[model samples]
Target: MVLWVFGYGSLIWKAGFRYEERLVGFINGYSRVFYQGSTDHRGTPDYPGRTVTLEPSHGEVCWGVAYKVSGEEDEQIALSYLEVREKQYDTKVYLDFFTDPNTTTPAVSGVMVYIGSPNKKLNPNYLGPASLEEIAEQIINAEGPSGPNRDYIFQLENALLEIGCEDKHVMDLANAVRKTLSEMKMDS
Candidate 1:
């Protein structure tokens, strides 16, 4: 059984399972924008947020990678991504999307995905503005069982770049984190 998954934000490249098919999907109603969405280590419950959502279907093209997997693999992928966003909302899905017609790659088959949820009831106080600078600073400065957000930024950055779906918000966070780390080094 082949399963199709949609990754609008970070999951496109972050999936731990291997996919048989890969395509560039243009998801409607959403853009790669960062807003406070979760309490998970990646984005926080409220303040320290990451970009992931759809406002209005503006027809704006964002690159998403679709992958095919079996039922067991699908569950594992979902479980491996076990975080507040996935469990709290369970909003990942596999739906209609138009891929670039120009590409010579074969059209991928449709399947299931983990769609993002609409439950905003988890919103919390803003630790700060939802800026790349802010997110980077928070991750760099974060402490607790959560670990460092900068590490998440770096790993996500590498994976996204490898897949060619790099987002401005992510890059911004990377740079901000790097700068802050460098400054901290000098201060030390």
Candidate 2:
């Protein structure tokens, strides 16, 4: 059985695991939101970076890439890699599809997704929901061992566009960040 992993955020640009194949796909009944906070990869505990989380929204689809792992061993390796990378999320096996626009093959199913719940007590970085301006402010001021929070947003925006996916929320946040940075430069 092929193991499929769905990536809607950083994994689109920075999937550290090896995969046999990848396809553009979307998971239905869920919407992507920057409601999850990042205290490790993107920011420190004192100032966390906003990251995407899959929230249930009927009739909505979250577009992303699905990576296919070949065998049992690779599946284990991929799972292990994702465990460290996506430690903040709660894993779930979803019946989703990975579609290739140019292929005659039908969409693939049984894709696994990582989701973070706002009410989950284990996730200290879970910031739940916030206004766009509030998120942008935190992102603009956050810098962690990985890099600046702005860089993460910029890269994810670029990656989404490149993959033929448009996320208005992410793009809007990116724009806000840019505007805030410009204002800060002028003030300084």
Candidate 3:
């Protein structure tokens, strides 16, 4: 069977896997937050990097992309790759994807999404609810096998802009990180 996967974070900028089709869309009833800690991709265990996790928010819609895996073999490969890449995200949910941000019609249904829950037990790497500056500070100096954590924020910001999706949280954090980086350069 074909599979549809929703990308709200790094997946937007880098799918890192093969897919038959990709469509820009959004899902309702969720708000993207940088509440998940990333020890594997963006930081070490000692200093975990912050990443996006969808928090259940009524009346909120998170804009992202949906990738369709057509072949069964390709679907298996894509899911396996994602499972490893998103190892820290312990929860998975399915939601309807709407291409039109303002429309209620779903272009695709039962699109899979990986989530890092706020429950510490379920999501061991969850670092829930921090101030914008606090998160930027953590993101600033954090690096992992993937690369600098700051790059993640900037890339996501740019990707969202490219897709015509204006996310306040992402924009604010990106600005904060940029300002912090500028201040650091001035200080040195």
Candidate 4:
């Protein structure tokens, strides 16, 4: 058995599991946003950090990486690892994966993607929408077991760039986080 898993967040840069193949691709009808609260990874319950989640948007394409896990044992191990790591993402969907956003046909189909929803009931860690500055400020100050929240944004920004995909939302937030960190340092 073979399984394709999509990684739009930390998975892009830090897919901790073993996979046979990796492909850069985009999933349709979803725009990535820093709306999910990361209490476990990037911050604490008292001060949760923002992370990426797919918000349904027509004509939108979120680019990331797709890892191919082959062998029944490897697929099971990968899925088990992912289930624990991505516990916060309450929804899992298998969607067609495309190499290009403008592509008429998908390069791979039935790729599994973990999604965190805006509904508070479904995703208790949903931070929802905030102004750029507000989100940046939160990201700048929050830290958890994983590391600093700002580092998450920076790493994700760099990872996306490395893949030759530029996400404006990620870029803008990364810039905001940088500016916010700079201003805080100057004020100190």
TM-score list, all predictions = 0.65, 0.92, 0.98, 0.97
Write out the backbone clash pairs for model 3: none
Candidates' lDDT values, in order? 0.56, 0.85, 0.94, 0.94
Candidate no. 4 TM-score? 0.97
Candidate 2's residue-wise lDDT over 1-188, tens digit each?
A: 78888899999988898899988878778888988888888888888888888889997778899888998898899989889889878646676674754554448767888888866666667787788889999999888888998999999999999988888989998999999899999999
lDDT of candidate 4 over 31-99, digit per residue (tens): 999999999999999999999999999988899999999999999899999999999989999999999
Candidate 4 lDDT at 114 equals: 95
**How accurate locally is residue 182 in candidate 4, as Cα lDDT from 0 to 100?**
85
Which model scores highest in TM-score?
A: 3
What ordering of candidates by lDDT runs from best to worst?
3, 4, 2, 1
Ten residues in sequence with the least summed lDDT for candidate 3:
96-105
User: 93-113 in candidate 3: lDDT tens per residue?
Assistant: 999999986677899999999
- Model 3 local distance difference test score: 0.94
Q: What's the true lDDT of residue 138 in model 3?
A: 99
